[model samples]
Target: MSRASARNVLLVEDDTAIATVIIAALEDEGFKIEHCTSVAARDGWLRGHAFDVMLTDVMLEDGDGLASLDSVRKAAPDMPVIVLSAQNTLDTAVRASDSDAFEYFPKPFDLDELVQAVQQACGGSGSSANLPDEPDDDGMPLVGRSQAMQSVYRMITRVLRNDLTVLVTGESGTGKELVAEAIHQLGSRRSGPFVAVNTAAIPADLIESELFGHEKGAFTGAVAQAIGKFEQANGGTLFLDEIGDMPAEAQTRLLRALQSGRIRRVGGRQEIAVDVRIVAATNRDLVPMISAGTFREDLYYRLNVVPIELPPLRDRREDIDVLCQHFLSQAVEEGLPRRQLSADALEKLRGRNWRGNVRELRNVVYRLALMARDDVIDPGSLADIIGDEQLPIGQSGDVRTSGIGQALETWLAAENPSAGSVYSQAIAAFEKPLIEHALGRTSGNQLRAAKLLGINRNTLRKRIGELGIEPDRFARPL
Candidate 1:
């Protein structure tokens, strides 16, 4: 370890206690510490001296420390800046990343993490450039509270300020486009347009011309010069969805563009420089594609610089209730009648296999809002809406498609709750959907349901009252 006198650390923190603790910790680790209470003092110190690293708190007594990031970059481009802030939301994290912070610590952070970051910085020569100032925070559309989702959020936040290519992998309808849009909207390139191209959706022959543009008379149908997605997305983000399907010729050109930061129009000689960020998404496994000679392994490495793997909806079932509510609100905004899901209805939704992930869930919510007879959606209405969407089972013969037993097993595994009420809970789960389904089919006529269910009408009414089943909702319209 170097002597404390040989290395200097500039710390800008308004809180006296935090500053003292941080200063003491760095000094013990053989680092010389220079403390500033506000951005004003930091600016004054920036003129005459340089430091090994900088530790800054976003909020300060005089002005925000984050706003002074440009000054630090200007004064010493190679000095790494670690941000500390009490504002621990995603917005703050993204902003810290946008400013090209070496590391960011929320207030009440682990001191050991900070120490390790500083030690790493001290041993290395920092060369990454400062990121341009980013736009105001635009909330991301990603909806989930599971640990899996949290990891995705962290990765997104880390890449917001950089031009690094990101490869998002997940099943279809897992909102890969949503992830791409969020990164573009929240990053320095928000002022630029976001262009998206689905590689799989386009024909094989036209993929290159579609992405790299074409000059007049380039091909048989080239009557005029046309801008490609690469040129159109210059200074912004280009989302290449389903990249695993990109043709070999286009993949070769894409690799060239990525390497040279330039694109050449079809049938034209000039190399046009473009300042675009690429975000690619695919459901197919690229490793297998590479092995099969479908996807280029070299190109895959270039695009997979930062990989964000989104967990399927089934893996994050804890988010289903919130997602349903979010979709319900979106429906109301779009002139649909307001609708709320009953507890049992939400439970039913949580229990299903979301083969289509968030997209399928949104469709079900919209259908329930449109077709359900009442404002409060019950388990029966949801079941009916979702049942209509059951996709044909594939070769895997997934057990989730078999019945509600799969859903209950998943819920039971997650809960591992007391076994005493397991029988009752299981019975209620089956009974509510069945009884309400019968009531809906019979136009809410108890006698008809009793006959259909092979039970006494009095007994049917008793079960209806016990389950809080609103039979009126299932009555046929006049």
Candidate 2:
């Protein structure tokens, strides 16, 4: 039969509701499915049946569904299998990846995406994942079960079996390094070294040498032949933290290395071939930098092959309690006194801006574990620890601004729109709004608006024209 008629699917799911939903959706898509709730029945059905694809769950009534996949693979080795699981952890995602599942869908997934995936999977076995030995350690490097994190987990699983350049972008302290560790430690290169270099921390002068080692006599401080991060991370991942801060010259060498899969030591004759996966991360917005010519656009494309953007803790406040608990356990392991988290304290935590994100939360949790007077931590204890620092930006609290000085400070730090046009850019950004406000208050009367704004009427008119502001819209009859 042609690929279009390849709609025979076997679903091994235990949940009645989930099975009903999947069966209905698949049947509606014109797929003929054989549904079973247990691995025993699945195996019995597989004994005489042929299927184009299989969809199974991790946990079943009798035995582990993933373990039973060996028989299915042997029976129909070419058949693609998709695994669904409510055990929504990175480990399960990795395990499903290890079992050669075409796709791993976490519980409460979108039905439309599932149907789309089923339609695509029926066509061919085009998955790039290879069966590698599953990681032995069950440690959870990352936390949170929110839908945002599930998207992260799925993306991580997709890259475990291959060497794909990954770019992780997020605000500071959003666990970019943890994502890097998860990718390396759970992947086929787990045995290889995981080398991380913060490009932002390194001086512009030394970044090139830091990344691609220099010869013993290459520079003034070249007392010995140094191994660069590229050599150190051979056969594993090279995590370039704050890639946006890489100097122009270093960006050139880095792009060449990525292009050639090799690098030449500074002042060295021979180039060395290195087997390494590139995982770059940046807290800064690189697109703006690229436009400003501060960051290389070509390098951005090279590193952004598989982009995974992490949400800030403020966006995922529902995860605050679990993250706090996780950090509390970690604090105790580090010899801090153990403490129970009170519901009121957790509720209090849900309010703050969490400007520092997970790293900030972890710090607060550790401090609470250390400074709490009582065994059960409460809001009183939290207040004592974070006293006078809470900005009242949390749930049901007022979001107070830090004034224009603070706004300018934040803008300068984030944008650095200087580039010899700082004044012009600043004026271009703020002048339009200020003029619009004055016009609004004066009903677009140019003379009164100019007088209110303390500027000449002609100047106001010229600016209004330059800013493309139509004061007539805000005007009223004299």
Candidate 3:
């Protein structure tokens, strides 16, 4: 705490209200504060004095704060800079990261965290040496300013400078692939080729050949020599989609490749060294798969060096309106009839539980753009399009008519799962979601969730780990 007594902070923020809050917080922490309202005043202060760290906003009265950090850095090359901006987007985050700022905080950030970040910057707990700030024309792909997305943006920026393998997990249609794309496009590997392969889409028999660049004449169908994903992504990135679906044999090989940074083609004895950064994504619950012995625990740890858990769309319903508009614009650009969504229509859209996440919303918007009768769509038309998404339950909402019954019937018809194992399989399937529902309502608190589920806390905790359920995702951010 005494470290900040002699440390100095030069804050460049134009908003009086925001400046007051930051100044008050830093002063309470025993730091010497020099506040400026514009980039001009900021540079002047930098020229006249020396400060341990600088905090600047993106937009200033006279010029761009981030764009102008170069001059400030030239004046004080060693001074770490933290950027604050209301423009919350992946683009802004990448720019802030590319500028080599100590930290980038989207607006509505926690004041306490801000103070702590300044403390760390001044204390040199993290390296914050200044570097040139550059701008990219087309890095603003992902949308939504909700806190959920903000958390994602921050995590993305943190890994831009390194080649740590990232495991992106979320439900289907939650834009898991988009996270992979963002990291590949904005990170240090931006210039390298990005190769993506869906393990689930490829045949299990050929999964290894597809990934390791199957040796020619290695297998019956392998008549010609073929290069694998590793060779294709040499010196760049390989995005392994649906990694949980990879066969067990392939999992072992993948683990070896990740560990050794070398791959051996199928039927070939020679080991070829390749430099490739891995970014794997999956919508399936990998922990459960690992527990079920379908997925490799060692391989999971290797790919999960940096875990980025993407929030489902339902969790960020506040962004529904913006997402609708974004999709509508895309629809327009694609030559669909331009349509406007009314407040009531958006209200109706937001009301539904978006079980399909962002992908579902985009599809519905695109459909509305093409099919709506009027230019401005209302709630009536919206409901008609969305139409009774719920199951055909009885008046009392009987369990038979609900989705679980239908799924049970389908499973009985399909897998048959063996008469001896049917009960266990059904329990395995239904019990996971039942526990998930409890943890969800209790915000991932094991003790509280256990009480609600009428089970012992330790039992519920044990079941959670055994089922590979991640309780932290259900826990709301503080």
Off by over 4 Å in 1: 1-89, 95-134, 388-478
lDDT of 1 by residue, 248-367 (tens): 998999999999999999989999999999999988889988999989999999999999998999998988988998899999999989999999988878887775689878976876
- Score residue 404 of candidate 1 by CA lDDT: 51
How close is each model in CA RMSD to the real structure?
14.8, 11.5, 10.1
Candidate 3 total steric clashes: 1
- Tell me the lDDT of model 1 at 429: 45
> Residue-wise lDDT of candidate 2 within 1-478, one digit each (tens)?
1124437989999999999999988888789989999988998888899888889999999989987888888778888889898887778888888888898899989998888888888777737647566677567699987888899999998888779999999987899999999999998898999999999778889998999999999989899998999999999999999898788999999999999999999979899999999999988788999999999999999999999999999888988988998998888889989998899889989987675689878867876786566899887766655542443123232223322232344346655465746456446545765687678678888899999989999999888756546676667754
Predict model 2's lDDT versus the native. Answer: 0.83
Candidate 2 residues lying further than 4 Å off, grouped into runs, are: 1-6, 126-129, 388-478
Best by TM-score: 3
TM-score of 2: 0.79
Between candidates 2 and 3, the one scoring higher on TM-score is 3
Go through the candidates in order and give the clash count of each. 0, 2, 1
lDDT of each: 0.81, 0.83, 0.82
TM-score of each: 0.62, 0.79, 0.80
